[model samples]
Target: MMDANVSDQRLRHQHQGLWLVAGIAGVLLLAAASIAIGAEDLSPGQAWDAVTAFDPADNRHLLVRHLRIPRALAALLVGAALGAAGVVMQALTRNPLADPGLLGVNAGAAAGIAIAIAFFGQAEAGAYVWFGLGGAALSGLAVYLLGGVRQGMNPVRVVLAGSALTVMFLALTHMVTINSEAEVFDQFRHWTVGSLEGRGFAALGAVALPIGAGLLIVAGLARRLDAVALGDDLARSLGSHPGRTWALAAFAVILLAGAATAAAGPITFLGLTAPHAARAIVGTAHRRLLPGAMLLSAGTMIVADMAGRMVARPGEVGVGIMIALIGGPFFIALVRGRRLGHS
Candidate 1:
């Protein structure tokens, strides 16, 4: 019996490892495409030469070195951040539809960034990440209080509270932007629409720590979440603290979402869709699910960003718009499928 169990565990790891490899491969391929295909297309050889073989005179080399690489990294990091956050949130709520946005985390982060720009004139990402994290924490706390933890945490009430808060925070963001200087509006507008136009390594570096910390927290919470998903009573009986799990998971989500929003604004649907797709590949186990979703989302974001460049040509569509165009249909289909399944 012991030998059989060990064999089963090994097999599971091997299977999950394969999916992880596939995810990595997909992201790498798309990232390469992201660097190579753009406003001015560059061959893979040229892309490499741009890095290895220097030519300051070549505009393509400068574009590759300065623009494409940074944008791709930003998209990849933000996508992975949101994807990981989404997985943690869905597990906590036991609701497949639960995303960081459903809890107003993204809106709060955006509001924070807007406030920073409007009030403090701090427009850099370093300031954005901090203000964003602060805003997210406040919004999450509001939801927690309104969510009725004293009576036991109800996922439905929490979601509703989040929905209400999201509206309020979004309005607050707009009010600040509208009331501020026209320059603020111009800057905020670009970010709000979610573009990757001129972001560089500085932007990525600003959010990396928070995002990394969030990923670490999510990883620690995965097994505990597995226990919690079985129900609070069952989780406690198994020696997991469901309350602690919720607190930590919520913190992790806020961290991830805030940092991502700080980097690329409030991107929707990637979070909601990535987990479901990962589940199909890795089943319900979060250890596999988190990485799978992260890779899938990272690849998807790179693809959406590249496609945005292609569709608009001289003028490009925002990555946010491209994502919505893809994810909106997927969301509709998911809802329809759920309804049909229930019926």
Candidate 2:
């Protein structure tokens, strides 16, 4: 019996390894497709050459090099960041349905961006990144403090606090939007839609540090997160510091989700859907789960972005709109089908 159990475990591990490799391959393929399938069609060879070589005289090469490449990279990086942050937030709260956006992280970031544009008249992407990060960090701290988890942190309380805060920020955002000048509102509308258009490598460069640091922190904590899944007291007994682990996870979420939102505005449901889909395919072990979630998210976003560009026939549907269209039903189903705490 012992030998049989060991063999079964090994087989499961092998299967998981296969899934991870396959997922990563799919993401790469989707990214390549995204680059090739934009408005101006380019053969794979041309696109490859365009990306590699520089010719100021060649408009096609310049477009591919300066536009599509950076846009594709932004989609991949933002999707990966949101996916990884979603997994961390879900694990930290022990709630399968938890999403970074739903927990006020995105709202806080959006609010910050809106305020910056309305007051400062500065709507630049680089400046928005800092504002968004600051807002998200402050909101997350507020949620944690108000959630009232004295004996031990309760997922429900934290989620509730986050939800309330989200509602408040969203209301404030709308108020500001409504009262702002037409020109400011016009600019705000574009920023809110979440497009990958016209972005350069510099936008990706801005997020590299925070996203890289967050991913490293998450990777190192994979084992600890697994222990956390065993319950707080048990995790502590096993020599893991639950409080410190939770704080680190929260910080990771802020850095990742904030930067992504700042880069692409608010993308609805990628975080919620991606991690849950990954968990459904692979069981709830953090080590396997995080990578699967990241790949799935990256692939999903790339596909959605490609579809949006194609479906609109010259005009493109913004990524935010596409995600919302797909994510709305999924979110409802997840909420309706299960008891609140089961996740």
Q: Pick the candidate with the highest lDDT.
A: 1
* Clashing pairs for predicted structure model 2, backbone only: 96-343
Model 1 weakest 10-residue run by lDDT: 334-343
Query: Residue-wise lDDT of candidate 2 within 1-343, one digit each (tens)?
Result: 9999999999988998999999988889888888888777788988888867767889888888877888888898889999999998888787776788745778888888888888887767766667777778777878877767465666778888899999998898899889999887887788788877666787778777888888889988999999886788889999998877877887788888878887888887898888877776776789988998888888878888898888886888998888888778876886787543544
Kindly give the stretch of ten consecutive residues in candidate 2 with the minimal lDDT sum.
334-343
Best by TM-score: 2
Model 2 earns a TM-score of 0.92
Model 1, 1-343: lDDT tens digits are 9999999989988988998998898898899789999877888999999889979999999998888988888889889998999888888888877788877888888898898888888876656667877888789888878988777777889899999999999999989998999999887887788777777777777788888999999998888988987788998999998878888888888778878887787788999888887776787787888899999888888988999999988778888889999889977877766541121
Error of 2 at 49 (Å): 1.1
Q: Name the regions of candidate 1 deviating beyond 4 angstroms.
A: 1-13, 122-129, 148-152, 335-343
Model 2 global lDDT (CA atoms, 0 to 1): 0.82
State the RMSD for candidate 1: 3.0
